[model samples]
Target: MPSFTLPRAARITRITRTHKIAVAVLAAAGATSGLAVTSAPDTAQAASEHAPAAVKPVDAKGQPAKADDAKTGRAVTASVADHVKVDSVAKQHSAKQAASRSAERPAVKDYPLSIMKDKGIPGSYEGLHRNIMRESAGDPNAVNGWDVNAVNGTPSKGLLQVIQPTFDTYHVEGTPNKLTDPIANITAAANYAADRYGSIDNVDSAY
Candidate 1:
C-alpha cells in the first residue's frame, strides 16, 4: 500500500543478518578444528612444565650412590672417588722415587792415615810430642841443668832434643838451628817418629 518495492532500510537489515549467520558458523567450525589439532601438543607441554623433574635413584636402604654415578649427574653419591685413586697412584710413585734415590746415594768412608800424612803430619810424630811435653811442658827452650855436657847444652836443641846427631838425621833442608823454631823442629820430629813407630797412634800411646 505504501510502496510496491521493499524499503531501503529493510533490504540493508536482511543482508546484515545473513552475513552475521555465515560468520558465526565459520567461527564455530574453526574453533573446533583448532582444538582437535593442538590438544595433544598442549597437554604434553603443560605436563613438562608443571610436573616435577626426575629424581636421582637411591639404594633400597636410601644411602647415597657411588662416585661414578654422582659424576654422571646423579645425586646422593660421592664425587671424589676418582680423585682419591689418582692421589694413591701419585703417592706410590713418589715413594718409589725416594727409595731409588736412597739406593743410589754414595757411602762415606772412615778417615785414613795416608790422608793425614798428606796433610804434613806423619804417622809417627805422636811419641815425640808427648816426650817434649813431659820434659819441658812442651816448651822448646826448657833446660836440663842437672846434666853436664848435654850436647851444646842450651836446653834441648829442638822439639826432640835434636842435638847435632838428631839434627843431621832428621833436619828439613830449609829449617833453622834454634830449638824454638816450631816448624823446623816439628817437621824433623814427625819424620823421625814416623820411621820409629808403625803409626802415630802407637807413638802417642808410648808417650
Candidate 2:
C-alpha cells in the first residue's frame, strides 16, 4: 500500500515547531527571566570593580591632597599651576604701575638751593628773621599803626615793615604780594639791607 504525503505549507509548519522546541530547551538551561546570562571566570569575579578614581591635587609645597582637592574631590594640580602664573603676572603689573607713578611724580631735586640763594640777599637773612620775629612774630598779614601813609601811621606789612616804594624795588618775581608775603618781604628786606647798610649788622642802627 502507498503512504499519503503532506503539502509544502504543512511541511514548513512542522519544521518551525521542531526549531521552537530546540530553542526552548537551550533557554531553560542558561536563561534568567528573558535574558541569556553567562557567568564570569573565578579570577575576574574576585577582582575589585569600582568607579574611576580621581587624581589628588597638590599644594604650593608639593604636598598631595590639598583643601581644594578635598572640596572638589578632583585633581587641581593644573588649576594650582595656573593660579601661580596669574599671581606672578599680577605682581609684575603692580610693580610696573608703582614705578610709573614714581616717575610721573615731581622729583625733590627739581627745586635747588642755588635758585633760592640767587634770589636771596646774603648776611641779611639772620637780621630779617630776628626783626620779623620781633615786629609781626612772622605773621603774614600783620598790620601796624592803622592805615596812615607818610607822617607816622604808615602800614607795615608781613614779617618785615616794608613800605610800598621799597616793595616795588626788591619784590621777588612771580609773587602776588611785594610786602604782604613773609618770604618775599624777608627777601626784599634782606636785599635792601645789603644795599643800604652793606650788611645786616648795621641795619639796627639805621632803624
Candidate 3:
C-alpha cells in the first residue's frame, strides 16, 4: 500500500462537501416535516368523505323505524286473536238461536191422533178430533169458565172439556184423577158418553 496524505485544500474541499451533505439532509428533513403538516388536513378530509354514513335499522319496506319493522309480526298475532274472538261470538250466537228455536216449537206435536185409537175409545177419530177442535183447538190446557158448566163453580177443563163433577163421576180405571190429564180426560169422557149415549161417536154436542 502507498502512504497517502490529503492536501489542505483537498481536506477543506472534503469538509465543505460534508457540510453541504448535512445541509441537504437537514433541508430534506424540514421538507418532510412540512409535508406531514400540510397532508394531515387532507388525510383527515379524505377519511371524513369516505367514511360510512350513519345507518339506522330498516323494515321490510325499508323504513328507518324499529316499530314499523315490528308491525308485521304484531299484525299476525292480532289477526289470530281477532279471528278467535269472532269465532267464539259466532258460536255463542248460534247456540242461543238454536235454543230459542227449540223453545218456540209448538207443543201440539207432543201427542198424535193415533193415541186416541189405541185407548179403545168408542168414537170416530174425525168426530173426536172435530169436537176437540171446537172445544180447545187441541190445546191440552184449555179451560172453560164462561160456559154453563163453569157457572156452577165446577169449571170444565182439559182437552175434552169435562166438568170436575163429571170427570170425578165417570173417570175410567187406570186413568189419572186430574181432569186436565189428556189421555185420562178423553177416557173418562168416552166412558161417560158410552154409559149415557151408547158411544161417544153417537154424540158430538155437550154431554
Candidate 4:
C-alpha cells in the first residue's frame, strides 16, 4: 500500500498557472468595460447631430410667429370692412335726405305787368298804376306795419296794401298765389274795386 504526495515544486508550478489564467481573464474584462465607457459620449454626440431640430410655430404667411396671429389679422380685416360699409351707407342716406329737402322748396317765377289784361280781368293800367303808387309807391312787397290790421296781426300786404282776407277772397286765377306778385295784387284789387265801386278807373282815393 503506497500513499505518496505530489512533489512541492510541481504543486507550486500548478498554482502559478492557475493564478496567471485568472489574471488574464480579469484584464480582458477590464479592457471591454473601458471601451464601453469611452465610446458613450461620442455615440450620444452623433445621435444629437443627426436628430431633427425643435419645431417652431408659424403663421399662414410662413413667418416665424404664433400660429394664432393669422386669425387675429383676419378678424381685424373683417372689422375694417364692416366699418367701411356702414360709413358708405350713412353717407348715402345723408345725401338722399339732403336731396329730399331741396326738392320740397318751390321755384319762384317772374310775371309780366300785363297779366291782368291777358287773363280777362276788368282793370285799366292807369287806374291800377295810380292806386299802386298811392298805396305802396309801386312796391310789390310793401306792407302796412303801423295800421289797425298790423296791430291785429293781419298786416296789409302787396302793391295795393290789401289784407290777407281781401286777397284770399278776390284772388285772380292764372297768376301766382303770392301777395307780393305785382300782377296778382293788381288784378285782385281791381276786381274788388269793380265789385264795390263798379270799376277800377272810377276810384282815385284809398278805396
Candidate 5:
C-alpha cells in the first residue's frame, strides 16, 4: 500500500448540510461495521497532530546518548551503565582484599621457636615453656613408646609429643617441617593444643 500525508491546510474539509443528512440516513439504515466516511477528515487530522518525532542522529563521541528517535519514552541505557560501573568496582575491591591477605601471611622458617614473637603465639613464653617441659622434659628427641599414637605406628616425638598426622595438620606457618626439630615441634604442638583444649598451658595431662 502507498502512504500519503495531506497538508494541515488541506485537512479541514468543507462539510455541507447534505453530508449531515446523509449520515442520519446511514444511521437509520442500521449499518453494523462499515467506516463512517463522513468523519474521515477529522480522524486524519487528529492522527497527523499526534504523530511521533523523528530519530536524531549520533554525535562524534562514543558515549551513549538519547537519540531524537520518534519514541515518546526515554531509552533504558542509564541503569545499564550504572550496573557496569558497580561490577567494575566490586571486582577491584575483591582483588585488593586478596592481595592484602597474601601479604599478611607469614613465611616458613628453619626454627619455629626463634620466631615466637613473630608468629604472635597467644600465651606467655613461661606458660608455653612449662607445658613443653611436662610433655617432653625439654628433650626434642623424646619418644612415647607405649602411647596410643605409638601403638598405631605414628609415634609422638620431640619437645611436645605430637603424632605425625596431628603435627602435620596443625603445623603453623614459618615453622620447620620436622617432628624432631624442637622449635617446629613446640610450635605445632602449641597450635594443636590451642585448637583442642584452648591452649597448651590449659592441658594438665597427655592430651
Candidate 6:
C-alpha cells in the first residue's frame, strides 16, 4: 500500500485538540489541590489561605493548652541577676554598719603617764605590774599547766602570759618573736588588751 498522510490543516487541528485535552486534565488535577491556573507562582499562598486550621494540643480536661511565653527564659535570668545584686548590696551594707559600730566605741584611757612613757607603751605600769603579778609573778618563762588554755594545747606563757597565737598576732613590728622575751611578751599583751578593752589599764581581771 502507498504511504498515507493527513493534509497540513488536518494535522494542525489534531495537535490543537490534543493540547486542549492535556490542559483540561491538568486543570482538573489542580482544582482538587487548590492550585491557581492563572497565576502559578501564587498557587501555594492561595492554597495556604484556604487551608483548614491545624489541630491544637489539649489538656486533660479537653481545654486547649496555653503556650509558654517566649519571655519566660529572659524573666528567670533577670530574676537571678537581681537576686545576686541585692545580696551583694546587703552584704556590703552590713560590713559598713559593722565597721561604723567598731569605730564609734571610745578607747579606754586609765593608764599612768609615767609608765606609758617609760615602757614605750600607752598603758599604765601599775596595770601591767598588777596583771603580771597575778598571772606569773613576773616570770618570763611561766607556763600554766591546769588552765583551760593549757587543756586546749595553747597554754599562756611569758611575763604577760600570752598564748602563742595571741603573741604572734600582736607582736610589735620591731620586737623579737620569742614568747619568753620580757619586752616582746609585755608589748604583745598590752597591744591585745588595748584592742579588746581599749587599754591594758582598763583590764583589772584575767583578760
Compare candidates 2 and 3 on TM-score and give the better one.
3
Superposed Cα RMSD, model 3:
16.0
Name the regions of candidate 4 deviating beyond 4 angstroms. 1-115, 118-120
User: Which tens-of-lDDT digit does each residue in 67-145 have in candidate 3?
Assistant: 6435555644555577789999999999999999887863443332344445555665665677777778888799998
Per-residue CA lDDT of model 2 for 1-207, tens digit only, reads: 899899999999999899899898877754764353344435555554443566665665567766767677445656677889999999999999999988886453322122236765555335655666776786778777654543565566766677767888877665456578655666666667768877554566323
Better of 2 and 4 by lDDT: 4
- Which parts of model 6 are misplaced by more than 4 Å? 1-121
- How many residue pairs clash in all the candidates, one count each? 1, 0, 0, 0, 2, 0
Pairs in steric clash, model 6: none
Per-residue lDDT of model 4, residues 100-120, tens digit only:
987775322213335555655
Candidate 1: regions farther than 4 A off: 1-121, 124-129, 147-155, 199-201, 204-207
lDDT of each: 0.58, 0.65, 0.75, 0.77, 0.71, 0.77
Global lDDT for candidate 1? 0.58
Worst 10 residues of 3 by lDDT: 106-115
lDDT of 1 by residue, 54-136 (tens): 66555434656566654564433343455567789999999999999877763211122233345555553345456556546
The model with the greater TM-score, 2 or 4, is 4
Candidate 6, position 124, lDDT? 71
TM-score of every candidate relative to the true structure: 0.32, 0.41, 0.42, 0.43, 0.43, 0.42
Candidate 5: where are CA atoms >4 Å away?
1-117
Please give the lDDT score for candidate 4.
0.77
Clashing pairs in 4: none
lDDT of model 1, residue 110: 14
Looking at model 5, which ten-residue stretch has the lowest summed lDDT?
A: 68-77
lDDT by residue (46-144, candidate 5, tens digit) is 888888975553322334445442243234344456668889999999999999987776433323444655665544566667877888888889999
